[model samples]
Target: MPVTWRDLLDIFLVALLLYTLYRLMVGTRALNLVRGVLVYLLVWFIASLLGLSTLSWLLGNAATLGAFALIVVFQPELRAFLERLGRGQRFSSGPLALEELLLGLSRLSEKRRGALIALERRTPLGEYAVSGEILDARLSARLLETLFYPGTPLHDGGAILRGERLFAAGCVFPISESQIGLGTRHRAALGLSEVSDALVIVVSEETGAIRVAEGGRLSPPLSLEALRERLKGVARA
Candidate 1:
């Protein structure tokens, strides 16, 4: 049979759909579920091909049930994906503003002041705002420094940045369950990164070192210049 332009279009559409699904599944627990589904599908295909009707039937029914189970288990990821899809623009920091933030972090690191700052990206972190004192003030380097200064009321907890605004302070973040032997601030940063696509910055009070947490992983201690470059990348994203 000769393939027409319409057939090419159909194939392209299917390939695009599969690629989208793969991209969505990456770096998520759903990826594991997808692998399991693929394995099941391969097994089912082999059973049917070898004339094992009973095995094929059982696998087919299990696959059908598993689809619903996945929906329930991955509800959060699904919701987040839909939310991102509906958003008008991808949230990112401006280069100049990010530089200012890095400047603030540099001073904090120099002073050996501990800090945890989570920059909200696609995920709405309003739920966490209620747990802290909501400032809703414009973001500035001085304000960031003051927020983390020693002997201050809000110095102990994390700060949440929504866009160019400092949305909340004294915000309590979840502690990471990972076996990474880190301080409270680092653990909190990791925890926030694990749950949302937020960029978390942590300053070590003891070592005056800076760390970045993203995608449930923590970066090694970063220098001021390295931190600025990292923030620039986030802003561009």
Candidate 2:
């Protein structure tokens, strides 16, 4: 068949779809599974080309089963992707009460109170919020300080911020298993950051250090000014 613009357009669309899917899977656990599947497919192709009949047949059969299994295993990521697509999010540079956020975190750090806060960005932290009490309260330095107050019942759990509001408190976030020798609050901050685009802030009860976790990596103790810049960066992203 003669080449046509339609053929080029079709190929471009497929490439775009694959790229989009890869980007969506990047911050999620499904990325590893995708790599494994790609490796398996490569091996299958090589086997077929090399005339390894038995090996090719076995891999082919396993591939069929794997395709169905992956659908079940990636349910959470799939649902989240669909929901995000439906809602359509864009990073807005609108005003945020960052000073209030900083003031609260600064005081928490000074008091040597452990605190874990996840700020929702393009990704939704709704699932984790459901794990704790819903506050839906106004955002302020006092509110942030009070939530992580040692005497408060919600002190042990993490808090989540949605936009300019304190969406939820006493929220339980996933704990990261990658880093060793980390305190509980730091581990939890890294855990949620690893899975989503959310920026997680942590305060060490022992040392009163302020740290931010993002893209699966933990930052060293940051000064209050540095922390303010990070929050502003997220808002402007």
Candidate 3:
């Protein structure tokens, strides 16, 4: 049947939604493979439209074969995407509960105590927990303070937050081998970002400045209040 205006509009809307999904999936390694597959499919589509039966049949078979390969090759990306469905909005973690964290970090900063708080995003951080002791405690200012207190049992490693729950504690994050002089907190922040989309809030023991790292980038030094607001925005995005 010939396409009408309403049919064209429907196709455009569907294409737009698919394109948006494609953009969301573009950051990871699987994007290149997906693009290649799309190109092949496009070629086949054009060939079929033009009535090139032989080329179309070959391309169709190639697509069928590629579909199976894609299922295997893109498993990681597929899992990540599926996990994000609950989040609804892309890269947003909903609203963060930050009052307790803000107060806790403020006091720590006043005392010039260093701390690393890693907020979990889509990626599961269970593997990283193998490096240190795991404490599944409720999220609270006092617990965070106790963990980071000088000479405390879990002071040395990062704290992981999954939703409003403290998923794990004393988690030793992998340090980057970069020759640049980033200390444990900075390296830990970057390391977590590399592995997951988690936001890392770092309070410097030396300078008592607060900073947040996400998407492998660190924001400028912020006060305790500014840091809280920034984190809330990140979660709300």
Which candidate ranks first by lDDT, i.e. highest? 2
Q: Which sections of candidate 3 miss by over 4 Å?
A: 1-97, 177-179
Model 1 CA deviation exceeding 4 Å by range: 43-73, 88-92, 150-153, 174-180
lDDT of each: 0.82, 0.82, 0.73
TM-score of each: 0.78, 0.86, 0.63
Q: What is candidate 3's TM-score against the reference?
A: 0.63
Residue pairs in collision within model 1: none
Best of the candidates, TM-score: 2
Q: List the residue pairs that clash in candidate 2.
A: none
Q: Is candidate 1 or candidate 3 better by TM-score?
A: 1
Q: In candidate 1, how many Å is residue 200 off? A: 1.8
As a whole number from 0 to 100, the lDDT of residue 125 in candidate 2 is 81
Candidate 2 lDDT tens digits, 157-195: 988888887889999887887787998889899888766
Ranked by TM-score from best down, the candidates are 2, 1, 3
**Model 1, span 1-237: residue lDDT tens:** 999999999999999988987765555455676788788889999999999999999988988898899899767666656654555233467766677788899888898989999988877777677899999887788999999988899999999888877889999887776736878889899877765677899999998899999877789999988887887777788
Q: Report the error of model 1 at residue 18, Å.
A: 2.9
**lDDT of candidate 1?**
0.82
